[model samples]
Target: MIEHRITSRSVGALGSSGVDMSFLLGPAVSSINTVRILAGGGLGEHPAETWQVFYVLSGLVEVTGSDDTHDAPRTIVLEPEQAVQWAPGEQRSSRALVDSLVVLIEATEQIPSARPL
Candidate 1:
């Protein structure tokens, strides 16, 4: 069995200022991948094919979707154990109101590149 401990030293940058991540379960996992992240008011834009689930370990996150620019942004305050899922083909970004820890779960199998929504 594989077991490990993650610390701040293990986190890496996520293309945004003050956002860091650690891979708890990588692409080697046949079904799913899990990651832990620490973020501070940073924004990230990703393509739509990747489906994701975000669980807040602490603090609050405001999520906005790129598809609906005129729509009001969604503010979700997640304490420990709270989580949310982003549907496939939805472009989303997030920011942390305060220091926050989050867990991201993604499918290990690659989504088809031809489909973008």
Candidate 2:
């Protein structure tokens, strides 16, 4: 079994934007992670082929994205206790409006469909 304390875990670079993140659960276990973004920091935008979830733990953040049908991007501000899920094929990105803590969970899972003979 794997166990970790969020506060005890050290923060590391998330992406090119200089955001900090702690892996409460790494991708090896599952794509579950907790992230902290300092003011003006953000995760770069990307398109997802599968659904993903983000839960706001504290502070404020602005989520912006555009779907396949919409050429314009919509912005949503999330505060503590608020959560947002993005659909597959949607472009998404997040920025810390203030110092923020968020938990990210990727719903996609890769399980072997068949066993080798």
Candidate 3:
């Protein structure tokens, strides 16, 4: 069985940008991952390579993105139990407002919407 300590231990994701990532599933058509970032830590803006969802597990974060719509950039604040999704080719970035844990899902399937953050 695959077992892991997603919160406290590294699951082989290389550390960078003041974030720690752990794998919960695959590196295939779909995958589940966790991102742990301290207050003020974050990922820089980059074009999404696949359908992606970032869900907050604890604390707070602000996600900024400019999607295929090509509209002006938008920022969404997320707290515990909140999330934001980005379509492939969208440019996005995120910053941790407080010590936070976030789950990242990358897939080709249609992800259902959760309570809007």
lDDT of 3 by residue, 1-117 (tens): 001123323344554455554333333438878999899999998988887778788999988887544458878778875666777887889999999999888878535433222
In model 1, which runs have C-alpha deviations exceeding 4 angstroms? 1-40, 66-73, 108-117
Q: Estimate each model's TM-score.
A: 0.48, 0.61, 0.69
lDDT for model 1, on a 0 to 1 scale? 0.49
Q: Write the per-residue lDDT of candidate 2 for residues 4-89, one digit (tens) a residue.
A: 12322334545345455433322422476899999999998988656556668898988887644466887778787565566667
Instruction: Output the lDDT of residue 56, model 3.
Output: 83
Leading candidate by TM-score: 3
Ranking by lDDT: 3, 2, 1
Please give the distance, in angstroms, between residue 18's alpha carbon in candidate 1 and its true position after superposition: 35
> After TM-score superposition, what is the CA distance of residue 46 in candidate 2 from its true location, in Å?
1.1
Off by over 4 Å in 3: 1-29, 68-70, 113-117
lDDT of 2 at 109: 39
lDDT of 1 by residue, 2-115 (tens): 011332333345655565543333352234443444456645866445545555667776555533334554554555545545556766777777777676656543322212
Q: Which of 1 and 2 is the better model by TM-score?
A: 2
lDDT of the structure predicted as candidate 2: 0.64
